[model samples]
Target: MTATRAIVVMGVSGSGKTSVADGLAAALGTAFIEGDSLHPAGNVEKMSRGVPLTDEDRWPWLDTIGQALAGSLDAGKSVVVSCSALKKIYRDRLRQSAGGALTFVFLKGSRDLLTARMAARHGHFMPASLLDSQLATLEDPSGEAGVVTVGIDAAVETIVARALDGLKTVG
Candidate 1:
């Protein structure tokens, strides 16, 4: 990984993006941003109501994430962000906004595992019902440049380690 790369931990709901990204930022000695926290109120309301956000709803949120990444990079600090980033266009938008100095850690998992994980969570605005919509929106980033694809079936530590190992090859 480069000295100042902005890393995005990406996947559908319940894929452990937060746990992994937090670990990754700690391991890298950088700051971590929870992408969901940056969502506008309206977007959060929609999701909390079990409604999938439209592309119109996502652009502003994506831009906010991008700005956060860019701001951190401008301060010469490496940063890790947790985001769904479910589509290629969304990733591309982030890449552009971060001036191309971005890497993504894509958490890949089976639907059954993801559903189970979502069901076990509590107090989150996102509902397990929205998992299918997120899965449908996801465009696998496996072959994309600057992307590290890691399986999410392991313990958080193991998964973070795997992601760290994978990030080593990102340019």
Candidate 2:
């Protein structure tokens, strides 16, 4: 039998985390969490103005996301959540919330592909201009425990299948 995963779908701003996580959640029969919703107003404001966030700006937001994940896990619910999770320290902090229960799915993609996707997106506060900042901040999670890396070039269905297969293999 396959195990249920409380996963964080992590990547740069335009790496299709939302599309992939939503598909995976449906396939896995779990809750779909939009981690951007947990971001504080100040953080959103900063991003909307094309400003990069300092670590100080993210602590409260990460804490809030961690709390939500912890709450869902403690309630025995499995969820697929979307977060940039651009740094190892950020992932480490979230690990404190649920220990080994959290798996991070890294949506790896080329900058050109991601930037085009971001440019084509509508109504998101994160502008395509900030893609560089996000890419710069991202720390590869290939060596991290409980991490599944899936390329974002494929269709959403393919990405979901690959990620689920990766989870099974890693587990």
Tell me the number of clashing residue pairs for each predicted model: 0, 0
Give each model's whole-structure lDDT.
0.95, 0.89
- Give the best candidate by lDDT: 1
Residues 80-157, model 2: lDDT tens digits: 889999999999998897666789999999999998999898999999889899888989998798899999998889
lDDT of 2 at 62: 88
Off by over 4 Å in 2: 1-4
- Return model 2's CA RMSD, one decimal: 1.2
Residue 116, candidate 1: alpha-carbon lDDT: 98
- Best candidate (score: TM-score): 1
lDDT of 1 by residue, 1-171 (tens): 348889999999999999999999999888999999999999999999999999999999999999999999899989999999999999999999999999999999999999999999999999999999999999999999999999999999999999999988887
Worst window of 10 by summed lDDT in candidate 1: 1-10
Error of 1 at 106 (Å): 0.2
Tally clashing residue pairs in candidate 2: 0
Error of 1 at 58 (Å): 0.3
